[model samples]
Target: MLCFGIILRHILYQKKEAMFWYNFETHNFETHIGWGFLSAFYIASIFALQVI
Candidate 1:
């Protein structure tokens, strides 16, 4: 489970462009909110699966 979790995290981070400083400030606030919502949605999906 730990390995699978790490792999999922790696895959998600790999596609993201602004992982650090410079591009961070350039992006709009809505972009960050969208990412946050996406992350939350994935997390909730995982939890729902576990519950089932």
Candidate 2:
């Protein structure tokens, strides 16, 4: 019974850690893409307005 409890706790801990990493990675990706698109839009607008 004691061994079973330990195994369950370890599994839960690993799962929580994995979830945290996944969420962090997803948020980072979203932030990067959002900023990239925003910057690109501004740059394109500037170029277009320059009439070049």
Give the whole-model CA lDDT for all candidates, comma-separated: 0.63, 0.60
Model 1 TM-score relative to the real fold: 0.47
Best by TM-score: 1
Query: TM-scores for all candidates?
Result: 0.47, 0.45
Candidate 2, residues 15-40, lDDT tens digits: the string is: 55565577577776765565556556
- Residue 36 error for model 2, in Å? 31
Candidate 1: deviation at residue 18, Å? 5.5
Give the CA lDDT, 0 to 100, for residue 51 in model 2: 62
Candidate 1, 1-52: lDDT as tens digits: 7567667766766644453232386666776777777767767756765666
